[model samples]
Target: MNTLYRLGQFSIALTFPALAILLAVFGLPAVLLFLSSLNAPDFSLTNYEAFFSRGANVRVLLQTVEVSVIATLMCVIVGYPTAYIFAAASKGLRMALLVLVVIPYLTSFLVRTYAWIVILGDGGLINTLLLELGLISSPIPLIYNRMAVYIGMVHIMLPIMVLPLVSVMVGIDKSLSAAARSMGARPFAAFCRVFFPLSLPGVLSGSLLVFVLCLGFYITPAALGGLGDAMLSTFIAAQVESSFDLARIAASSFVLLGLAAVVLGIFGLDLSGAQDSRPHPAWKSPPDWLRSFGAPTRRVKELAARHRAKRWASTLYQAAGRGHLWKVVGTAFVALVMFYLLFPSVVVIIMSFSAGPSLHFPPRALSLQWYRSFFNNPSWTDAAWISIQIGLAVAVLSTIVGTLAAYGLSRTFPRLRSTLTMTILTPITIPSIVVGIAAYLGLLKVGLIGTKTGIILTHSIGATAYVVVIVSATLANFDRRLELAAKSMRASPLRAFTRVTLPLVRPGIIAGALFAFLHSFDEVVQTSLVSGFSVRTLPLKMWENIRHEIDPTIAAVASMLVLLPVAWLIVFYFTLWRSRPTVSGVPLETAS
Candidate 1:
């Protein structure tokens, strides 16, 4: 057993090159960012002093906390019921709604953010509607405030809140709630006393995730927020563009990192909340009166016997009073939620065909003007190609590195695995703005600024974290006995893994690769910082355009981006859901 273990360990050691490259690219830049804080006059804490000296600077912390808390609370309020829907829905409904939740999530962040601008701008859809209805004489100020920032953040954070909650909620025993209802408890009463408690851990997990991510959020806040409403991310960008003082940049980066670290410490990153503690199953049965709601009032037999065809209308009226109303309301609420999630993408697609400018919805005439404009511009086409190439490279790079790291860590015990997993996800936890600053400073030290190599390296660092998380999840449910059986036949370790384990986990690898590609293509913060004059990608083009003009060309570009990922995702999902093994070209029956 010792010899076998050593051979397996040696095979795992082959993955170290990928790991080492990650350390050099990600780890080294982090070190340089720290060194930047120490580069002030005579190695003193001058930059640190500057940060703390201003009351206004300190307010950014308070403001970040305030916004994060508000956004997190809203996510919980809106997301809790929605997550319940996801976990509790039937198979077909669950698949469709899950896609609804995921598509905008995977859509380009800038494109999604841009959608909000169109809907909330002065000449936007809402304003246009109100003018026609005589609700207001002019457009309401919607898009450039703390409120707008919160809306966009919630839209982005909803899935992050729901996914973890659903994971925890699914494991819950539906029997407990059913049993309570079977006796005499009302549905709401049974849920509050029984179901809600078991789901708290998921709530805690998801709420913490939203809060922490919101603390470091940039894109939405930057796009939608005014100067007074600027989150910490906005200031970080300002510091980056305005100063050659590396220490100032580093100080700002450290503050962002420091806040993130504190958040992780408080929440501990185990959003599932499965490890440490859980709500005790301590609630006893409620009073007899409380249980009465679950028992339907007016027995079914009694009602049928008492009410003849002559009184059928009265019986129908009683049924509506009992439970039919709330059911209708709940279904309507879910529909509205789905529409809100889809609205921005829908608006962006429609606006892409506008014959005139200003990006208002329901244009007078639809035309392919923007599409033609996009194709005709050499700069746009060139940038599109560059983005595609970079995305593909980042995809391959992140997938290989992440899979290797995940395989090595999966071979370890749970405790060590958790620690390493957190380390790998460090890039993700830090603000992207901070990441851009650190990479800019670090690459400058190495004279790699304004280079595609620098952008690729930075993107892979950020992108690798997602691949690791996704692949690691897939490996957790993996069956290891097949590899053991190969080893029992005296197959080489590499052959055992490749010929057995790898094939089983290929779907996960492919999924991770897709995410890596999307991350590379949509990434704006780090790429914008690193690609000074040498490289330009599609996202950079959009970012630059949005800062100056709301051209329909951007909407055309955004629509293309939205359709590409969504189309690929739909194919991938249908393939996965619809796929089945075949025996001699006949599909094997899948027993439900």
Candidate 2:
């Protein structure tokens, strides 16, 4: 019994060191940001007061909320039908569409956002098409407005909505809708009454994710919305980039953090009604006395619709391939949405092969000249090398810390798990612009600003959040018996864990590392704030060129960036697959 107690204590004790480091890394900057906001030659609330007192600040905050709400609604409207079709799709088709969605999702954020500029800018694809068809005298001013912001944001957010919605919809019992139809309900009515409400949890979750991400949007709006349509992040960034007012910047960061918290609340919302364990209120046949005489005409119409649905349902039941008009439309719309999701990446790749010095819709000719330019340019290549180093460093540090934190959380008491989870994700929960300001202020106080070591440490704070989430989830499914078996054979707990547990969860660790690397490699908001002239990363370098309207070379760089992650993803899994043993000491491929 004493040994068993120590064994349990040993598992719990392992979490302490990781938890302490996580606390120091995330907590210190947070405290610093608050103190920085109080800096006004002495400790004071002047910055907070100034941040709130300005009318423009309030208006921008309001505008940010308004745009976020509209964007969330638009994502739902565009994503619902597509999700429905995907949920009902055959296995092959569903897998294919999922890959299409993930390709752009895994691509560079700036690269995709930048492609929209080329497609919508002056004398760009849309305008060229308009000119060719003689629809307008000149460009229609498509690039720098709320319309463009919505288009770019919605295209990016659509997949976020579809993924969650499809997961929920696929689990819904089709029998519920079929039973409703057989009981004289119309197709649309049955769908509305049965499936849509049940899918609300997913809708709410996805909408909230999109809304919070929209709050922190820096690139898409900046590139596409122009100056007049700036987001909250734009103002926050302006404080860092233009004004250098660290106090007000930190204050503004807190304000944006508040709004993001409100959106995260939507994730915790319980709209699915699945928790009501009690049986639903009893139903009985309707009687003439309960029916209102004045509603007779409405009842007649409803009955007619039901009759039509019953006939259609019969047809669908008898012939498996038959589908309704709405289904057909929904499927086609999903295809178009998939194309939209992939379109920007496609445009970047195509333009990478262009021979010209400027961006055009369909290039008159193609060559590898721009690619060669990226290779030959010392400035671009050196910056990329720096980014690669930073990414690797961040990936390693974040993965180690994150894996430990995940282990700690898994061994912690269940009652405390939710609080721990939220605490670990706090860095991600806050807007990046806020984090950037906080990191910049915190690092400067320690004389680490512009240093590679400082930048790598700063990047790891955010990267660790991703690793913790991924590794914790993977650990949730892990079997403890294998480790127990090793322990029963007289192995120490640490040895048991290393020998038995780590191999099974290695994939998750590697995945966490990969994500951390990509995030650090592509990191912009924080890097932009902290980096000096000597510390230009590839993203920062491209950002400078983007503002100056330097094309072609950026297109080539974007194309390579787009494919690099995909290649890494394939190679990582290939190596892992080869390392796994089969039933008779063969690899998986040859075992059969």
Candidate 3:
């Protein structure tokens, strides 16, 4: 008991479990992979040279950056106005709108990508509608193109872009814009000057998040793109399957990693602490320069003076009508964005019930055929059961270790906490394919490859990161005085936590556990690398079916995955309701 108490006093000790697992599974292997890439002890850039010498490899590398940038830009264009509208909305409306955005964000990635295939294929919804209308003689080339790749990627990433933007935008004081307007600034000018500048942090963070995730894309490109549109992830996947060459794979992985790091450095997210929030001088030079509202306000004052002679009542009525028109336009825009985000999932759910042999939207007849096929097939059932078991194990392991780490980090020095936190999050932030390659090398050395244990460990690394971030956000708002009060009453540290701190943060713990499960269940890229074909999780099975055959039965599996998010929301609602007065202040997804 004395030993246990002494160890608990050292907050950093609580992070050991998470750090140990991360090092064994990822950090050490990554170092080895880098060494192998350089032919260590007698290092050379031969592998890198060989990689660049291939013209096809060079093209693919450039193409990956191109696609990621374009997709990120598209997300910003669509997401900015939508998020502005979300911020301006009433509380009830904002929550409803946020739910709409988050549902798609939480949906399975592969399922979302597959939803596009059902909609854009040669015989898909659009083509079928066109043929029925007799607008065209034959199907247009919609699927398997660069355009489809962007459409699918933007669909998947839009919520990620919007959530952070909304979190930041919602926190901006509306009165700042009102103050600008009261100073004779027009609504548009006030927004451009006051609100938009205040929201720049969101834009930087959202775009950075979307761009980095896009860099490591593997499944979406593979599913939606043609041979000419291959990204680096697809290229790396090809190498893994064909050559199994360690140095080449490592070199390619590092190149992709380097691209992501360079972008991250350019944007410069201060992961060690909060961004420096002190306002900068408007006249400051590039990089530190801030936009000035002075010019826009001065111009608006001139316009107001010119219009001062106009009848005040007439001008007021005109402005009211214009406000009504803007509301209508904003409503339509939000509805359209919601449709783009959700229609694919609806199509998949409807198609799952199709009685026909192939996928069809508005299925000619609804039946239980696909669902029946899913259950009757032993392979599918076994794979699902394996995934469930692994998800549960991962959730249990990740929640305990991640919660402890979050608690420990909370008590540690700020600089040390930030540095350790960044290290922990690397698994999720970097390219999935790179993480997979490193995991493959790690498991191979331990002979855990092709085992269920290998897949669980790999999944746990990423899952634990999610748990830590969520719980840390909850902890940030937690009042330490409560715990100190309990300690003053003669309670042990562990007893005080289990009784006082634990109940208050129970909602976050529940959320972290569920996210951990979802992370493990939906995982595919890393799982594919470590599974070695001996253990098949549900995602692996679904991916194989998507690549090898167009199976309607897979739609049944996907439809089930779509419902998982709804279940999560229900669970969260109940958990939060029971634990009223829970932690607030931090937005959950924003921390993620």
Candidate 4:
């Protein structure tokens, strides 16, 4: 009974700080959004009605769904093979491939999106090279079109699809294929019958993740697709910033939110059915003679355990071993995907050094003139500063809020936990542009427009969901006993958390914070609406510059932005690595 009381006290202590943060940040803002949607003039569904009435708005919403679905499909098609190859490769090769995939993810999304602009634009590398090679007589209309939007979005979203698939694929048993092969099946047939079926979970998980993320994407599509291929995000931004129609904005947000919820629910149901349908193999105990031989003596039991461990280790080593031909093919495939991921960003970084006024991939002469010009521009510097300020604030605030939300949900009842987690993750499902519009409408009465505080608050609100999900994943792995120990020592809940829980969960907090910072830093749609002429973020500045004209200066700015997060990721990886145990066999707790 005393033990139970101590455990309860510790859980409450560890959970309350996180809960407080969530209530203040996510809970309040979400409630405000729901209220604003229903509270215009008189309680009515006018906003929702307005959303459906506009043909262009409805078209944009459909387009957003279509593009996201298509892009997610492409990501899965490409990502599945790449993930399979990675899983089949040597450990060194796999780690290298993983790093290559992750590096692009660490870079700013806006910068990477802008990089596609230079590649797909008129007189850009793709067209210029094609024309020079006589592959085409004229430049193709790749930029400001659906093709461009799909290309840019798929490029950005591919890694998101690949990582999750890889996570699941690595756990699959290689012997499954061998066992099928021994049963008279060909290698391809064996894989299809054995490996592919097992990989379905990863495929589905990656697909859902990519699809959800793509639904809310604004920067890449806006930059690459322009007016011809405007998505729901762009439409929402236009409604909020250009038209200033609060009712329309609120209605559109509600509809987008509803669509996201429906899609997620369908995906969840399918996943649940898949899990349920899988046959559970019965567990078998070790032979009675073996247990009897081991005896009740510690020495005999220890010897038997060591022998069993050695056998398992040998099996794992043999399983990881693959043919040379398979290794080469896997390496090449991983290299190609990594190239596809990094190619555009490399082009932009190289162009940043061009002495020319316009974007030139392989400059006739390389110089730092563009970098000089970018630094000299006060607007660029100011925007950079503003983006940094907002990003840091959002990161800190979101981390605090997300940690709390994660704790609260973790301690709550299991059935309610899923529902709460879904609510917290809803911001990611709802397009950022819709969130921007909703916030713009809700804050109008409170006079939050064009202020730094308003933009930070808005960015933080969207960012909190990401932090909550990530931190919650980390908290899931945490041992309840550590907190109980602290409580048993007669420590106050707050003191126990600060001294015991905080140190252990710090990594997750940092990871969540890093993601939150990047979320705000890369965001353009929301920033565009909430920010006045007085507060232009780096992404907004880049958007304006691209709208007006394309120059090497923008490329220079992008290169720097790309490097900042990459550096941070490197530092973060090393910190995590240092904290982990040196022994490879150590049981590491997973965040989720």
Query: Order of all candidates by lDDT, from best down to worst?
Result: 3, 1, 2, 4
**Candidate No. with top TM-score:** 3
Candidate 3's displacement at residue 562, Å, is 0.6
> What is the C-alpha local distance difference test score of each model?
0.79, 0.77, 0.88, 0.74
* Over 4 Å off, model 3: 270-273, 279-319, 581-592
lDDT score for residue 77 of model 2:
91
Clash count of each predicted structure: 3, 0, 0, 2
Question: Candidate 2, after superposition: displacement of residue 397 in Å?
Answer: 1.1
Error of 2 at 164 (Å): 2.5
Top candidate by lDDT: 3
Q: What is the per-residue lDDT of model 1 for residues 1-592, given as tens digits with 9 covering 90 to 100?
A: 5665675675456346455755776677778778768773457787888988988888987898899999999989988888887787786887778888888888888998888888888888888899999999989999789999999999888888877777778778999998886554557878898889889878877887788789878878888888878778778778767776677778877887888788778867652112654555647788999888757855885566455443643443354364677667767877877787888888889888888764557767899988999999999999999998989999999899889877877787667667666767777776777777777767787888888788888898878878888887777777677677778999777677777677556667888889999999999888878899689899988988877774569989988888977876866675555565332244534311
lDDT of 4 by residue, 1-592 (tens): 5564476544445345544444443455556667677774478876777778879887888888999899999898889999888887788988888888887887877777778778888889899999989999999988998888888888888888888789778888888888866554557878776788777777877788788778777777777876767776667666655786555666666677678778777867232112333522323568988778655697886787678666655564365355677768866877788888999889988988887666676888889998888789898888888889999998987787678767766787666666666655655655666666656655565687888888887877667777776777667777768677777888766666676667667777888888899889988877777776668898888888777775558888888887877777776776565675221234345422
Greater-TM-score candidate between 1 and 4: 1
Q: Which portions of model 1 show Cα errors greater than 4 Å?
A: 1-7, 10-18, 38-45, 182-186, 271-323, 579-592
**Candidate 2 lDDT, 1-592, residue by residue in tens:** 5674475575555445445644554467767777778893599888878977999998898888888889989999988888888888897898777767767777778887788888888777788888999999878899999989998888777787888888778887889888887776667888877777777767877887788888888888888896778889998877766887767777888789877876676456322222232323234557887666658699788887878867876765574453676677777787788778888888888877876677655777888888889899999999999999999999998898888777777777765665666666766766778777777766777787898977897788888878887788668777777667678898876666666667667777888999899989988888887776569999998887777776569999999998977786686666455567232233333211
- Backbone clashes, candidate 3: 0
Candidate 2 lDDT at 450 equals: 90
Give candidate 4's error at residue 192 in angstroms.
Answer: 3.1
Off by over 4 Å in 2: 1-22, 36-46, 178-184, 266-327, 572-592
